[model samples]
Target: MSTSMAENATKKLTLKSGDDELFEVEETVALQSQTIKHMIDEQWLGDVIPLPNVTGKILSKVIEYCRRHAGAGAGSGDASTSKSEDELVLATTTSGDDLKAFDADFVKVDRCTLFDLILAAHYLNIRTLMDLTFQTAADMMKKLTVEEVRTMFNIENDFTKEEEEKIQQEHPSAFK
Candidate 1:
């Protein structure tokens, strides 16, 4: 691609969050969101893309994830394709391991923030981000007992004592 054409292709997009904060992101990075890509393909280039369901904080995080994944050569090809041993090592260090570490840290947020991220990722049609956030939530639940899960999520237990006992009796392994 010519320099001018590449520059034009890399043009930045403005994303407006629910709080009315505007984020400038590269077209390639923003294209990671299927929703945004579809809107762009449909010729919706009128100023900023409004994300009415995403708060500024969660939107920022989502953009960060998109930017990282886009820049890391994700979906390009397998890292082992036509590369020397040293090149493969370097590629794994820079992309694979770093992205994994970033993902781990990214999900280390409060419950409210995590849920907001999940919702934003879903709304944006970012499958990878949605999966990461959902897996994090599932991991949290997996480590908690039923009572603990209810307490953490502020869920009211409507089951009567008799019903609860019956359930426990039927599923003794689950109660433990």
Candidate 2:
């Protein structure tokens, strides 16, 4: 087989999540994460790459996202990959409506799980995943009042009544 053929072949990497769960994924899928790619490059990685910051559930979701994306771009060999997450997300959202739909459904988890996926994606340096999760969070909070947003995130109301009133007065539209 040719070198390109060999490179395209399904190579597997084992990942060990923080909760001790193990996953075997294609190298193409795992390489979607710069963190995992760097781990593979910077060390004589053993059989398993350990992700100490991510739990199994989050890791599983990350892998699913990576697998879907890698499969989407397979064989196309498009060299116009974006450098920044903001640009990449914008570019991707315009180009692939199917992927956009997938991303919309993918982020429909409960708040805690969505936040966990965001942290895991950030840690993994998967910019697309990070952007998707962040956008989902922003979408969830966009139409909500400050109090409703606080309640959604379980954040305490730290400001005094007078301070709150001052803020409401200053930004009446935000309060409404």
Candidate 3:
């Protein structure tokens, strides 16, 4: 093979989403994702693989998550250091509390963007993103009334006022 061709093969992979948006990521980093892993395993297509389900905006976020977690599996850094994650968990209330606070704060976003993140996370096979987004959704629901959920998700109220009353009468805790 030509030296120039070998150099090209060693270059970072470029991923294109369904919307024709692109992401250039190291092959090592891309392999951290199971979706990419499968494609690589099967020797599918070329260096520039396309993901129809993922959009550019969401794909970028997924890449960020994969990069953080790529080293995690290799026993690489803070995440895989000598101490178990739980070792410090019980020691410092403030440490754990700080992380919890960080998690909460990091998840602040509108419903639609949050959903888009979820979809991208799922497609990218990034567990942390999926878990965080799900937890964020649950937290949002916990803070809202039933009507608030309906309004937030833009769900139509199917029952008429009379039907609603009848159902409410049958199930006293319906709204709650």
Candidate 4:
């Protein structure tokens, strides 16, 4: 690689969150989000790239996630691998236990923060972060009852008693 290319790869980009907090991150780290990469590619948006959908708190967490993953050598440029799913799994399991542990600890925040992370990950188009946050939420929901799940997400029950009974009767197995 050329010296200029290496310098460009390490160039820092300023990210401005919705709450107007600014963060400076490396080019490779910021490129983990396809949204930011698209913005940089289409137009160099001056000194700061604005992310209106993500708050400062959530944006910080997202930057932490990106930096850790990028430092672990994960990147969006490795789409040409010939390894199968099983092979990849085996490789990661054998060599990436520390990264796995880091991911586990990263998602151990409260439900509200987890949800915020999910929203930020989705809006930024960070696929791996989305998967991690989603899987964490799914794991939290497992073994919970319908009412418990609804309550956890602050969803209200809108069905009348008779409607609920009839639906349950029609799909008893689902209710179980």
Candidate 5:
């Protein structure tokens, strides 16, 4: 490769997940996470950025989200300049619809994966990912019984009978 070509190449960062999986992500993409941005700013440019709280599967999904949004300038406010006029027009017209569809398909995972995504998003401090995962979880809980919600999340009922009765009385519509 030419010297200028190599010089202009996007810099990459290696992220190590809890499961010992390493992912190569562009600096622009990884900087979407405030936690990662701070780490980089503080000279945390070691061999690999250790993400001890994120599993390989969830980290992969998070990287996928970051790559998509980074490419589209979702959080950074810098759109791509390489698109043709027709392509740009198409993206302008359908970007929102396309993103909505992508998000809907992205969150259609099992409960465990959903929770893993929520935890990973929170840890990474990626607001868009956090909001999307939280809203998805909330949508899953809508109109469900308390028992069903607990069962779905594998959460044991820790409230005493009195406490449960008081809560039910306070939020009668929720119970009903």
Candidate 6:
């Protein structure tokens, strides 16, 4: 097909990586990102826009988040007005039990995937997702002991015994 025709015909995109892995996403969803929008505007993307920084797995998950939010008209700059997230919460207040269940389940993800979701949400500029992910992370920090936190993330304790004790004293509530 001619280049102009190809450009016009493309409403979806296949983002490929150097390893030849591909991710399929809608133009509207992909364009939630300013980076992707610029690529579309400049017609720099062919059938497959290469995203070498993103692995196929992470990109796939990101695409899932983007697609869902996009379909709900949650992304930025659409002509149609969206209910503010607070307004959405208010409207759903009558169904409080259901919302609580959904929120609980939404955060039930592996630690690595939780961080991945946080990064993806931030990159796509999805505020609700980021807030949820960050809150989950903070909850983990609050609940886990210092040793437990170190074990969970495989982080080494750098402090000497005396230093560790001093820190514990300084932040007495952290250990409790």
Question: Which prediction has the highest lDDT against the true structure?
Answer: 1
Q: State which candidate, 1 or 6, has the greater TM-score.
A: 1
RMSD (Å) per prediction: 5.0, 6.0, 7.7, 6.0, 4.4, 7.0
Relative to the true structure, how large is the alpha-carbon lDDT of every model?
A: 0.82, 0.80, 0.69, 0.81, 0.80, 0.66
lDDT of 4 by residue, 1-176 (tens): 55665466457889999999999887767888999989989987488999999999999999988876765553224521423333334345443777799899999999899999999999999999999999999988876877998889789999999999999999987565
Residue 19, model 6, lDDT: 60
lDDT of 5 by residue, 66-122 (tens): 766665553223343433233344445546667788888999999889999999999
| Error of model 1, residue 13, in angstroms | 0.5
Considering TM-score, which of the candidate structures 2 and 6 is the better prediction for this target? 2
* Candidate order, TM-score descending: 1, 2, 4, 5, 3, 6
lDDT of 2 by residue, 61-172 (tens): 9988886687556434442231223323434554477877888889989989999998999999999998899998898888899889989878999999999999999999
Supply the global lDDT for candidate 4: 0.81
When summed lDDT is taken over every stretch of 10 residues in candidate 5, the lowest stretch is 75-84
Q: Compared with the true structure, what per-residue lDDT tens digits does model 6 show for residues 1-176? A: 45544443345677784467987665656776665677778978477787665566767766655554454553235322333333233344425464456556766888988887777667656666677789999998898888898998899998999998998899998788
Cα lDDT tens digits, model 3, 1-176, are 55644453344779999899989875656776778879879988786889899888778867765554443343435433322233223223334455456556656767887899888778878677789999888877888877899998899999899998888889876467
C-alpha lDDT (0 to 100) for residue 121 of candidate 1: 91
What is the Cα-based TM-score of model 6? 0.66
Q: List the residue pairs that clash in candidate 2.
A: none
Q: Native-vs-model 3 lDDT?
A: 0.69
Better of 2 and 3 by TM-score: 2
TM-score of each predicted structure versus truth? 0.84, 0.82, 0.67, 0.81, 0.80, 0.66
lDDT for 119 (candidate 2): 94
The whole-model C-alpha lDDT of candidate 5 against the native structure comes to 0.80
Positional deviation of 174 in candidate 1, in angstroms? 2.4
lDDT of 1 by residue, 48-124 (tens): 99989999988999988886776565335642233333334444556687889999999999999999999999999
Better of 2 and 3 by lDDT: 2
State residue 51's C-alpha deviation in candidate 2, in Å.
1.0
